[model samples]
Target: MHRARLARWVAGSVLLAAIGWLVSIAEAQEGAAAKAPAAGAKGEAAGRRARAGQLPPYYREVVSEEQRQKIYAIQAEYNSQIAELEAKVAQLRKERDAKIEAVLTPEQKKQIEDLRAAAKTKRQPRRQAKGNAPAAAPAPSKPAPATPKP
Candidate 1:
């Protein structure tokens, strides 16, 4: 008789656990289903904005398709120029450092190297965060024109 009672208790415990798990799964599924429509709407709105060239405020003056293309070209040109300038500056710094190293004590050279390393590390985190942050929100669209009288 005691053995039969123990077996029944074990069976009841297993059944309860299974039911709890299923209920939790069902709740999660329902929550996800409730959220999906809002998420889908947001995605569709973003798509429409993109198609309309409704970019962020910073780009307000350049949001038209033609203007955007021109801006891209200009940006590419500026990027190339900036890269070339940066390379030249780096080369100049290397030459200057070499000249200074010839005159500086070993301790002074080490200090300069430490400073350069510190600067590089400090800049890296800021650049990485900038890359990870969400894109800026787009500016509001212009009001629609009034319809003509019939």
Candidate 2:
């Protein structure tokens, strides 16, 4: 059981990592598109070179203008293909999640949901405390017992 649970966690982590990578790529492409200039050959060429500047430090430094254009062209060529594959991956992931959810008994499903809610409640206070939460009121002090003959 522990092994199975661990395997699930590992798989989930890998999936999350892949999703994050794809999202970053998509954002990069979107940013490049937004920054690309309107019309002229000079503007387009500049845009391509600018996009190439987004490359890692080593590659960005070594690549020539010609290479930048080529790299930019290659990225443009694959962008749509990558987007299609990402969409397919998302559909497959949704189906996989539905199938996994279906395997759970209703009671198990409810139990997991309750566990999630409990976990969320546990996190909420910590988050609030981390933020600008108001200081909690001090508990009222008890009055000293009536003084005996001292």
Candidate 3:
């Protein structure tokens, strides 16, 4: 029992040290990036943040290997159900959007497309300045000026 406790303590200590080392390395890289203004450091840092895996960050520190495996198994079991629901939701959205589009006149639709293109053009220079690719913006929802009612 004493030996088991000692081993667990040693393992935990090593894990903590490794985590600390990794954190320091990340901080060092960030510091270097901050010092170099032309490097587009913020975009790189944002990309790194986005790449954090699907697991909660705490899982890396607190969860035992066995518990992690069990959690992964549970997630796997739910994944198929989640995927099926997501597909259904997507199909429903597409059908709903088609119905909405059917209600709009061709002129209104063209106007919406024009507004979206304008917004995209306005955003392009800002994205380029930030060293990021221009992403498509959602179409502006401003309804055309209501024609005077008959």
Candidate 4:
């Protein structure tokens, strides 16, 4: 019983250390292309974040060697399929971005890049008070001209 507990602890510690090392290594190029995502890519970004934020299968669990081997076998069986699908998705995304970029004017492309950078800087949601009402009625957007048409 004591040996099993010790072994689990050691495994958890090693797992955490490896994850930390990977994060540290990835930090260098984390934002190389943070800006300039194609339109509707926000949903894709959120999906990626949701996946990354999920707990791993068998996370925080200690299992026997046989169970671990079974889990690994299952993982190995699916990993290749997952990799192939991921590569195809990446290729599709790249082609989609290229098509969109091709249609944009130089000025429009620059504006999109600037807007993307600003969006990456922050995501601030509008705040509403107790009542869902505007602070005040906006002035007439297009007031009548002072003089009538001659």
| Candidate 2 per-residue lDDT over residues 1-150, each given as its tens digit | 889868976887688678768877887788687775457955766565566435555888899978866777667655655676678678867977887899899999999999997776556656667875545533345678898767
Writing each residue's lDDT as its tens digit, candidate 3 over 30-94 gives: 75676654568656543443453245667878888777656665555345445655575577557
lDDT of model 4, residue 114 = 93
Q: Global CA lDDT of candidate 4, please?
A: 0.58
Please report, in order, the local distance difference test score of every candidate based on alpha carbons.
0.61, 0.71, 0.64, 0.58
Which segments of candidate 4 are over 4 A away from where they belong? 1-64, 120-150
lDDT for each residue of candidate 1 in 54-139, tens digit (9 for 90 to 100): 33468966477777656554454344345555575577557755764887889988998999977765566556667864444333
Model 2, position 79: C-alpha lDDT score: 64
Report each candidate's C-alpha RMSD, comma-separated, in the order given: 30.6, 11.5, 23.3, 23.5
Error of 3 at 54 (Å): 4.2
Segments of candidate 1 deviating more than 4 angstroms: 1-57, 60-62, 107-150
Can you tell me which runs of candidate 3 are displaced by over 4 Å? 1-54, 130-150
Top-lDDT candidate index: 2
Candidate 2 clashing pairs?
Answer: none
